[model samples]
Target: MAQNILINDLPLEIFIKILKEVDGVSLGKCRRVCKKWRDGIDGSDQIWHEVCRKEFKHSSEIAKRKAGNICRWYHIYKNLKMWIDITTFDKKVREFYKFSLHDKSHALDVDYGVLPLKDAKGVVFYDMSNLKYIPVAISETNCCKVTNNDHVSVILTKTGLYVQKCVDSNGVTEGFFKAENFVLSGEVIYFHNGTRAGELLLYRLSSQKKGPMSRPIFDTLAILPEGKFAVQLDVCERKNGPLIIASTFFEIILVEYDFFPHEQEPKCSFPVNKLTMYKRLLRLKDRLQSS
Candidate 1:
């Protein structure tokens, strides 16, 4: 008969190798088995990275890019799991929040669990996790657009543009400019200059400092012909840099910006037909109705 071997008697390297084959839920249970197994599981970042890779698929790449060198694999896995639960309509997640808004209130944008709402009293950043609100001291009457990420919040109004650090409510950096539309991604801001037709500007915040003292300066990133106007703007973070998409009434333009050169030519443009435009409008209408 073969000799009976105990799990605790196994070497940590071999034990971790076995744990690698286990799913995240199973790994959590394994932690409860004993101190040795728990330490082995918790100490290895590779295991959590592999788990994230297996579960999140393509999203793992995006999350990794965002997290950078300070890789908190365990936290990343938990965050992704929470996102999955929220997106998949988990009953427990759904039942966590039950709040009503005013009839005139409008949701500006949502990032992570924070929802920025424009209502009778300026803007409020509502934390979905804790059910708390951080009221921003700004007038909503002229506020055209507002967006936030985990780090900062950017707001555009008729008179000017404003940026506030998410952690510090009093730390606001204000800039006076006329922008038709804008999108905030991380520390970068891409906006359409209303004064000049077909002109798009890129503003990058200084990483060394935060708050009112450090203001962002912009440079002209791209310019189209007089008739072509960018109506919609979006930015996606890539391994190298950012991929910007600007949509006009007739065409969609893609521009890639890297750190070294800071600017590059438009990668490509796709023309849009009337039917495609109509379909997009219809979808927007349906979304508004549902909301």
Candidate 2:
């Protein structure tokens, strides 16, 4: 009888090469086969790096560019992959809350002291510290987004946009500005009326004064030529300052607004056919409706 060779009997290099062919999920399953397999998979970071690069391309790119020496690529990728698996596989709901509105997008924001929840009718600020719900703007609301710090919030309607300051104890203050589509950064909110093609308006708030009586003071930073039909705003803070990214129907524009020594023009712009995509989506929706 001819001698039979098992998979584990293969050379370590060849075994590792075989393991690299499969994904993280398959590799995880393989690790359970034997102690040798587990040691082979767990001992190498290169395998995880390759896996991360393949699956989490975007996240890997961000980790490479932004995350410094503090974060290891393999570790970040492993945690993220594990998180995705848990979230995707786990069917149980950890927490649940009842709300009146049906639409959930742009409806909830959480901060240290308060939690702001938006509905079609109005916005309700829930004080986490005191356990109280404070209602603000009882009128009909189309869309709303809150700031990261939870100190500011912007509400949108058919006519205009309303920016409100959420105070700790007293109540929500008046609108910071009644503009159109807006996005909140740290202390600044960017918006545009959509009347002027490629016009972007930026407003910075001063949080020097605190309390319900002392409201945030809004000042005009600049009115930039961003893009035609500006629809979205995104902000990222770098070493320089807050980097504003605005996406319009035609393209996406980036602006580095350093307040100390102001840079007038936008840093860069990328052409994107978002309008075409929107139209295609609408047509598809119509066809589905008709079908």
Cα RMSDs, all models: 19.1, 21.6
- Candidate 2 local Cα displacement, residue 47, angstroms: 24
Task: Give the TM-scores of the predictions, in the order they appear.
Answer: 0.39, 0.29
lDDT string, candidate 1, 210-273, tens digits: 6688666655566655676566554433323334445554444555434323222234332232
Candidate 1 versus the native: TM-score?
A: 0.39
How much lDDT does each candidate structure score?
Answer: 0.51, 0.46
Candidate 2 error regions (>4 Å):
1-81, 87-91, 94-116, 119-121, 125-143, 148-151, 164-178, 195-291
Candidate 2, residues 1-291: lDDT per residue as tens digits? Answer: 999999989998888888778887787788899899888887876777778888887766554332222224544464455432221231211111334544424233333223444555554554332224533333344434433233444445555555444432256443434566666555577887755534444333323476779755543333445224335554332222334444444333445433323322234321122222223223322332332
